[model samples]
Target: MTPPAPNIDPLTTPLERERVLAAYQRACAALEAAQQPNGAWAGEVVWNPMLICQYVICSHIVGREIPEPRKQRIRLSLELQRKRDGGWGMHPDVPPAPGDHDHHPNHDRDPAGLAGAHDSWMFHTVLGYVALRLLGADPNEPLLQDVRAWIHAHGGPYGVPTWGRAWLALLGLYPWSELQPLLPELWLLGDDSPMHPRRLYCHMRLIYLGLSYLYGARTQADASPLVEAIRGELYPEGWDVSRFRATRDQIASTDLYEPIGQSLEWLFAGARALSRAIPAVVRRRALARAWEHIEFEFASTNWVCLSPVNGMLFCLAMWSRDRRDPRLAQALQGLEYWMWEDDSEGLRICGARSDIWDTSFALQALCEGPQIDEAARAVDRASAWLPRAQLRADILGGREHYRESARGGWGFANEHHPWPVSDCTAEALEALLHAEHRGWDHAAARLDLSDKLAAVEFVLLRQNDDGGFGSYEPRRGSMLLARFNPAEMYGNCMLEYSYTECTASCVRGLAVALEALGANMPSELRARVQAGVDAGVQFLLGSQASNGAWPGFWGVNYTYGTFFSVAGLLAAGLDGEHVAVRRAVRHLISAQRDDGGWGERYEGVLESRERPLDADQPSRIVQTAWALLTLQQAAPERGREAIERGLRFLLDQQQPDGTWPHDAAVGVFFNTAVLDYRLYKLVFPTWALSRWLSR
Candidate 1:
């Protein structure tokens, strides 16, 4: 029933090629102008307002000197992000129309009537309220009072989420017994047990280790007058603390992204009872074991820990274990590595650094447009840095620390970032291989063949049984882990699942690595790599949605998934005329705007739902780049005109300073929270332009 697809050739007339090359030069020049002297291109990682508050509380707790200017910056961020009723939510709003910082005072008098009322979780609200008080805001300040009143309306600290309860208990505002027992003995679970800690997603497992130690030790901060004062403000009418244990399982409605089912609740209750009966010596051994694992994490990442969420919790736990510990001091100092400041948002934490991730893609994209002789210095610097950044050794304490083989894999952030993600590793390998295939002399930069082979092996180990790949390691836990997920503000926090984006990254990486190795590669290793690529290609073919779009795990939605899927298929030798490739090409063309741009809203990705293409939404530079690049890979012959139009859209949108205006969010996590990767605009558009010019 589908009409025969239009026939077209990507080969441009002389005039068209000239226009494409001009755009390519402009884009590359823009990136070069923006590149820093440090040999890295860093971009802002837009995160939630809760990060600002977490930094405030953690700095105060650790006795680190919080500069007055930084304090004011955090205050401004909270004030600007505040809802009409004086509350904060999961994400900040787009900036007030350029240059109009009127601070709209009279928006909504009733905090309950705010537009995103459900978006404000008790966890964030409680932290924000406390952070304000710590910054010397009066208890009776009208804004403070309104936020406090809202908290009570939502069941106060008693109804905070699981992580919030742990924090409040650590602050001495809540009783230790009120928390569900997170005993370290769980680490003793056999590998065959479904509940083994190693089976959890890397982030979740590491967070639990720190949390269980503090909980099992009944650790609480020393009593302070400020803590005592905030306690009164939070629970103003409190009388009997006896019922705290009874309310441990209670969660606020606003926080319920994933509800705890009855089975898990009953299981938790029985666990709590058993925890009370645990022998003191046995508990000591478990807590000691937990502390050692904590030490291993601190050593692995040089105290950056995985993400800021676990980083903050680990800071608190280490302080509890040994206040004078030098590791604790280093952890506090390293926190600044992820701290980002903006005039509008003030201060917040990044989800992770994007140095290697951004640079790898930048180099690979540049190879498509810029000659090695033209971007020589830039390419040499990046290539030199890439070798150093690759994980040359597995993490220390591999078995005891519950880490996977990381040698030659790339991390999401930087070398110091402990987690080696499958997609990040694949992208790193692909970038290096592509650069070499395009005549980059890796030997000139001292990068040897062994380095390339190790990267190939890393990807081979990460492919799942389905031929897809997960973010961190191969899948170890079942989806059934979701039932016990107590972090209600987010979904899919319990385990890592195979992702289309990750699978595609591996396919592309393997294909390029094999090409670069050629006959020089050992026959056995080449055979293994070839088989892996074949399986990955099948996975992509079978995973396509009926509508021809693929769902993305790490990016905004289907557009992101389809972009990677089509690119991987092309790299694996699928022809543009192939039915699957044609279907994908048609699917993307359907979403193109009249202006020849593409825009994908973050709402569908956040809600895990399908969205119709609507011209009503403004065009996004990032999505446009993704769509353009996919078209270039899947159907360049019939896609030249479309690609040209898209190129014009990007050129028109770029700022004179070489950056594109920040578009809609470019990334998402936990299926609900949205974050931004600021450099996506520059890197992807440049990549898209280069692809068109190459054709």
Candidate 2:
């Protein structure tokens, strides 16, 4: 039977709520300044609370201490996030929206509106409390008491999620056996074997690598006297190591969003039973093979490792491997990449980095910005350097990455990290298109980036039987790996799910790229684009639910998906009377709030065969921009007012410096819950104003 979750205390002193609000506001202002031309901040650029935290962290990084007003704002934000029990959520805009599918009863909505209800997730719990703690609440406060109690009840040190366990293992807090095997051994499987971790999504593979190494060595952390004491406090009963690993099937109900199927569960049971009998000689051979892949991962990422979960584990693994290992030492250099500081709280780890990813769009958004000359020198620098970032060759043992064809391109930062993300490339291209059209003084001289569009040629080759594209590359793996998904901090983030925004980005980018190539796009490539556009249009049309929204895979939620997807479809010619366009426009219109803007919950990004979680903010700057863009695409008939209202919302939210207050996350794609998108406010709003006042 599942255990009861920690009950977030319902009672709150009004004074406490006000304190949180002050911190939250201060954080928002600091993050607003971090935008690099485009909308993204720096790392894990996602929607909702991720964005909220960016503002908070940025506030602390710049402010001597969080200003009093800012601390109060942040504190209030956290206080309201307190559910009936002691746990916290990723966002305040989540939770309790009945009509919103994100809050649907059937799905594992946090009724409180959190996704990782996944109580097994120590990362969120630790970080969630850390956020509140930073906001000035006492760590020993009752709210944290419930959280600490919850973590302990779940198995405390032993009971954390695999990802969280990996982190604790890094700190030498938990032994690896309490975890299942993620050894490099899986990488030895036949190419066709779907079970291989190497074949898993990049984010998952990186995270698993860290888990595998630490688990392989059976490392255990040294417990402090307080930790030993708290262990008793967390679990009423003493910790039993053997019993913890035996409950492999044990999962919190909230975390069972995707339960392991009987087929896999039975298969795993059989594998475990067989491993016991494997000859020591054979086991030695397996370990050797596993080490080869481990070395490869280390080499590929320059030891920065993949994402944070894996990065953290890799940090521990390297440290254990050797105290002074260069890679391990370097790996620790970017710890701040994931950690955010706020006045209310000092610092906490964040999900991932946004360095190159955000800049790709930021550059483009700057291209589309009203003050195109604001960053003219920076634009020239970016334009000249962009062509240099393209992928002209494959990486070491590259194809095993299942990279498929290496066409089109990605601009999440530039070509060095080019993994061929469809939307990142498409969005980058659109931004470039904007710049090219703007005819900057150097536009003609620097027009050479045009030839680099050959990457789009690669994208045309990866289109699916359905005519849509997946992020990073073609969708080649199965959903079966989702069951092995070890990240309790997020669900199904280990594999590619069909994304409307990603597909749309590819569509629009391809169209723009083809136009730029002029006659260079061969008949074969043009035919592919034609097929992609036609199929994409149908898929999008078919995708519009009765409620009229398309959920996003890479960003905040539905409003995001609807805008990017509809923009792609209409741009590809499905506008005017197209039934799909009309329905989508109808949905956006229906959602338009009295404020003359639209808002959605980040929860809308989730798709439960059971239900969905909606992002719960009204009139977000990003959503409003997306809605305005869609209206222009599908309903120019609505005139400028539709666009006008959205622009006004963006303008209204804009700080005196011309940046908008972040209201939601503006990123989404294959993996990683996001943060950053500092430029979403600037770029999208700028685009909206330009479009509304079109010549």
Candidate 3:
């Protein structure tokens, strides 16, 4: 007879078990209460102040004055985000000190001169300064003076990045000719062409669509006294159009994340030459083509377009073509969907919404714990809502528009946000499967056999030739496209490449669906699901770093990636003793803190694949939960002590309201900006503790 397996559930003491049970109950109550009446859970996605700045700039250019009350709130937001040195950084990591602008080391000197001085990138600083002025802050005020000094020290607005240049140019503060050409004719390229815009990543292409349209139309605001005054303030030395033209390619060291390569420069020069050579009629036709694509996207996404970045650009493009167009007003109104307001933080435009992502994770967390009656009712509602959220039909002319099949997939934000992502669909499917496993007959009825089959088909279609999955679409362009990436503040953004997080999510979802569907699954669909899982597993196994971590594309560093990787492997029938699983568990155990939790700095996303350990950072509640979940799934026996201690850390940190502290940035985008998803604090911790109780 085989030896009996050791007891993996490590809750030995009655006191410890009692504490965990009580914590679970409180957490369940808190999460259930936080759910929306529509049965979805969405938290504010806090990003940098650049979004607010863009809102201000867009309103000013479009000739719509922000209401006085709204401007006061926007002013408060700017003041709260200001650094001690009177500059704004990408995120609010460094607290501002009162009246300490002069003493801050980077106040007088060029902030770029100091190592790790990312607290004030020129991109945010210039935009923040201008946004404050637009909101009626006095230019001669002491705080504004300090901001001006900082800007002058950083080589003035001339050194800001391409996106900054575009915004300034729209307001007539910068010359359009000086900016790099975003040729609308690129839309005319055939789908077979490697350089086609369709070959670019979804977000990149959409943003470029709006940008090129505006650039083609030469959309600029009519000059006013405010524009002239702001221009003088921006260039204290003097405002010379020729001198500004010379600094077209210049970027401040503080704002440079991915330096513009020689290849990209050549591409820009060629684009300028093409712009000059193209026949007037052909150029007109290309602009028309671009507008058609833009209008399609605007309608498909329920007028929200993709994100605030493109949404504003699309509005400007529409306004430039026909100011009285009804669609323009609707587009502007739709933008309010991305706005988050608070009496304290004022109004902020988030990068994107997270309703589907948050709801899927929250449902999974609820399913892992003991089923209280209230929790069960919440699960039923969420499960019902999720199936309804799935896209039931592909968009018309999806192939013509360079879109993948979204028929059975879920998007990151909601059903109205119709850009389906691989991981979002997978996580949503897994959440429904978990509900089905819990014997929720109502959920099963809502998500019938055909619906599940369509979802599996959607996931199966997202797998790349390399066996991994990209976010929105399959990899469409070469990795060499990185050499031509024009976005100065981001990296690896040119094409949709495969990511570990997306692959792992697909694998786990397919495997769980396969097991749950049992013999009810059709033979053909079952084989395709198995093939996708096997391919996805191979991709995961080969992608592990030498240090046993996987790099995350959408979240912070190794901790987030490793959790999904380990969980996916286990769901695919890999045992804890497998070399890959064992190495991953060892890595997590080694990285645990003295406080018995885990923390990963956002900078790890910028480091080499073998991210160095940052031992000095304080443990974060969300990352700690990720490590605990990974260990529980992959190494219960080996990670028992670490799990218990981590549990204690979480329990001690829980507030009287039953939620964990959201003190650190958890989500990341483009490997440069960090995001604070407020709901992450509730979902991941609740899941970890509940998993422990069930075991």
Candidate 4:
């Protein structure tokens, strides 16, 4: 017989009850100490190895020596992340523990099978090999040989995705013909055209604008011996430049997350053929237009360029244009903003800063606790930072870069990141409102009523016709646009689509805004807000799965989506007795573990299902907290037992310093890649425990 399961219930005898209170106090103190003087709670944005590799490549392009310490750190990061066969996983270390591999179709027991199960891609492997080589690892190093063998087994250099092919060409390791045509002329299309860059997601459009310039000019770095060495090692059978033209559309199965459709291929083929006949004057004008847009993006975002993917591509475009421009120096300097260094992993690039995102959640968590007054100092400090983080009207208006107005919204990271996201804006508004209602006395520099209304207006502008919200803009195009997705490293990244998470956040935030506005809100504005809330609720209700769960696009699986769904509806004035709320509560109850917590695997989100859990894959503190929060909002009376169990789980997991260890990734993008936002564990769990105790 198996040994009895571990007890997860809180040790709540009269003698042990004090420990919970002490733990809560410790957590509050830790957050207070961690707050930045600027009122932000910026945390590490842990991502894959590509950003580090991009950094090394950027340093090489700019002819700057990476500091000895940074170089060593890069080497160590690659060393720690490299799999047994010398390739890196898509995200880091994604295999299940021994005996925990479940019945997924992708499960494999061999080492290579384990790597594939974790979703290793040739796109990432090429970058890893390039990074190692740039860091001065010998070509004949055993690790390099192993990496080469893996690449060869997968399909060699030609099998790389579009981005990889472009990077290789930039390094002078591959020919330009290896990449499909990225037409800068597409910029000439009218705004009304469905193919306009404005309609694409911010990341896709930004990267495309810059990459098209590089491809159009056929820009490449000066050939060096190292480049020759890369070319030799990548193609052991000896490569011919002529071979690339024939295999432009060829991508390896390992690298292809979403294959370009034959129709898209035909369209691209036609564009390439038409480009040959275009007059030189038209080509020159198109390149100029592309350059102008690229420069505008840099100026707007302070050279950060949205994310590292586009940031580095913009840098490459600048380098290709005028290597000696003073602006290049500033762009290089700004790259440090995304660099994260730790004792174990050295340095890697974060997907984004996500300061506002983490801080908003942390504030909500603090306010939910019974002892708001006890945590007053921490609350005040963080609250003071929120109003300052909102975007001003002076930023880019929609007409110029095909951007939506950012006047009153908030972004994921800091003010320097110009794009305002729907969920982030909603969360920020909610946090600010919470601070005000709780009487945190934010009189020093709080946003006035006008500013608050402007934020509400921003949210209103982003609501889709269907009542949901997209990340950056309202849905300008259809999900079918993904059929032309060129980036095989990710999926569903081609267009902006509404998310259940963003929709929920917006509805809840508007409710708070309306409450704060009260009679002061204009009659028309209030009517608009009420309509949006109703439509949004309907969207959430309609989108709920047959299993009573909502799927999260930005976080792991149903847990993330359901939490926002239940809480948002309740915030919009739906009661616990509502059918949608009742079903959601049941789903949470069923998902609760024997240990009284909740755990969700990243694979579950990738596949949009409840993935089988590995025996060793224990419940996560973050998911447990989310479930607790959801239940409290949806049905407090019925969820009391589960909430207590979740609170106990948090108490048990709290570190001595009042932090939670970085568990598995809680953030996702493109429904495939798992990313870590370090503050999720600390902020969400602490928030849940505080609320549970207060209730």
What local distance difference test score does each model get? 0.76, 0.54, 0.83, 0.79
For residue 248, give model 1's deviation from the true position in Å.
Answer: 3.6
- Which candidate comes out best when scored by TM-score? 3
Ranking by lDDT: 3, 4, 1, 2
User: Where does the lowest 10-residue lDDT sum fall in candidate 4?
Assistant: 1-10
Q: Which candidate wins on lDDT?
A: 3
Give TM-scores for every candidate, taking all chains together and pairing residue i with residue i.
0.91, 0.76, 0.95, 0.93
Please, what are the lDDT tens digits per residue for candidate 1 over residues 1-695?
01112222345577766665666666677777666665556677776678768777777777776787888778776776665444666644333211223543322222111233354667788988988888778889777888898898888888888887777787787887878778788876677898888889888898898888889888787788988999998887773567686777678887767877898888888888889898999888888888888777777888787888788877877887788987777878768778888676677778778888888788878866647344556666677677677888888778667788988788888766767877788887777666666556356564578878888888888888888888888888877887888677788878877788999988888887787678878999999988998999999999898888888778878889999998888888888998988998888888788887986665667566656445455577888999998997777668867877888888788776556776566687887677778788889988887776655
Which tens-of-lDDT digit does each residue in 448-527 have in candidate 4?
A: 88888889999999989889888888878766677888887688788877789999999999988887778989999999
Model 3 Cα lDDT, one tens digit per residue, 1-695: 01112232544877888898789788888988989888888888878889889989988887788999899778767776677566988754555435533443222322111224447778999998888888888999988899999999888999988888888889887888878999998899888888889989999999999889888888998888888899999987787988877888888898788988787888899888888888989878988999898888888888987898999999898888888887766888888989988776778889989999999999988887777776788888888788888998999877788889988899999877988988999999888888777765253447878888888889888889999988898888888886887889888789888799999999999998898887988999899889999999999999999999888888877999999999899889899999999999999999888988888767778764544335554588898999999998888778999998999989998988889865677788788877888899998999898888877
Error of 4 at 245 (Å): 4.1
Clashing pairs in 1: 8-637, 10-637
The sequence of per-residue lDDT tens digits that candidate 2 reaches over residues 1-695 is 01112122235345533332232233233334554453333543332333233334323222225566656655544444344344543433333222213332222333223454432234445444444544566647676677777665555444345555454444334445545445545656788887766456666666666566556555444444543443454444666676666765555443333455676567656666665665766655665565555566556656544444555555555555565565554565534344455553323444544455555555554444333333455555555545454555555675655445554465354343435566766665665665566554245434344444566665565466676676665666786666765555467677665567777877877777666666766778777777777787766766766677777666666677787787777668655587777777887777777677876544454542213224442556777877886786578665445655565566556665555665545464433344445556665665454444331
Candidate 1 contains a number of clashing pairs equal to 2
Question: Judged by lDDT against the true structure, how good is candidate 3?
Answer: 0.83
- In candidate 1, where is summed lDDT lowest over 10 consecutive residues? 1-10
In model 1, the Cα lDDT at residue 369 comes to 61
Candidate 4 accuracy as lDDT: 0.79
